[model samples]
Target: MLIVEELHMLLLRPDGRVESAVSGNRLYGEVAAVLVDLALHGRISFSHEKHPTVDIVLTEPTGNPILDTTLQRLVPMRGKRLQSLVVSPKLDPLEVVVESLVVQGVLVRGERGFFGWGSERTPESDPAPELVLRSRLAAVLAGTGAPTQADLSLLSILQNLNAARAILRAECGDISARDLKKRIEQLTAGSPAGDAVAKAVNDAIAAAMVAIMTPVIVAATIT
Candidate 1:
């Protein structure tokens, strides 16, 4: 599964309900996941030792359509701070990924509007995918086993966003918040990013997590 896919999955409720996945703030995290996936895939390198902030530099192409396209966008942006890529008012980064999920039968996109006045598109996920995802995460999160790439990816998102507690509580009401903290510590201990890119990725992830705590920041990122 793609990092973006799991990121979207995390925002969904177990009963096919979506909390929020199409916002600038949430998209920021989603985009960071995608970028991290690329970095992990060796399609780019990050130079974070610059005086002020971190910078992203593209490497060889991965030949994957979505990832390659993202790299193409970053090519001309040399010397640009990585933060710029995390914020894009003109595009909803999750739109294409959500549509792909809909096509895969994992989600159904529906319109919620009144007489074409204020129509908005919403996503409804299939419960099976979510159930599977939740089970894998719950097991790995609370388990003492080694985490696979997919598990690490999901856990990274959870840790960075401070979402483990909320997601676990939603999944299992009897679960304690302490369990979530333990899982985060476990997953964070195994981050695979090198020193060069680690700072950039961490900064991006931190910004996204901060946005989760502040709705005003979320609103600021929107048009």
Candidate 2:
């Protein structure tokens, strides 16, 4: 599964509702995840600066629908700061991601409430993928093994969402939430990938945070 897909899976409960704690930031996280996946696949690259800008290295389709769609969108936005892409309402991919997952039989769509006053729900049709992903993250976070570049990317996004503690606390054995948070920070800071890869992932994450927080800060100040 693509990292963004895995992230969507992670952000969901078995009931298919997005985890309440991270719902507000889910769109930003998914956007960042897609960008990071693109960078890791060599379809894109990031500039190193105070606020990083993304450049498309290859326009070839990635075959994955989500990545391909996002790539097409980025074609015209080359060299734009990552924050711009993340914050743009046009870039949110939740519906596409959900549709893809539904088609893959990873999630099953249903409805709640009576009559027509209901909301849609997408409970899991296949739970194995998410279970395996959770185990992998737990192993890495528990210091049992090293993390791949993908793992680092996912960790960086989760940390930015302040979500690692909520998602992995149970699977990480007896580790305190405080310690788990610290482990995520340590791993994200010192990714196991080579320097260039580490820098790209870290910079993308930083830009994502700026994009996510800018509106909240503005709204708070205005009020």
TM-score of each: 0.73, 0.86
**Candidate 2 residue pairs in clash (backbone atoms < 3 Å):** none
Name the best candidate (by TM-score).
2
Lowest-lDDT window of 10 residues in candidate 2?
A: 192-201
Model 1: runs farther than 4 Å from truth?
A: 14-17, 20-24, 50-63, 90-92, 117-122, 170-179, 191-199, 208-223
Question: lDDT by residue for model 1 over 136-196, one digit each (tens)?
Answer: 7766665635566666666655556656566556543466767666656556666663434
Tens digit of lDDT per residue, candidate 2, span 1-223?
A: 7888899999999988889878777877888878877877889887777677889999999788888888888899999887677666666777778889999999998787577465578899999988898888888887897787778777767776778777666676787767777877788777646446456555655666776678999999999
Clashing pairs in model 1?
none
Superposed Cα deviation of residue 89, candidate 1 (Å): 3.8
Give residue 107's lDDT in candidate 2 (0 to 100). 96
> Each prediction's Cα RMSD?
4.9, 2.8
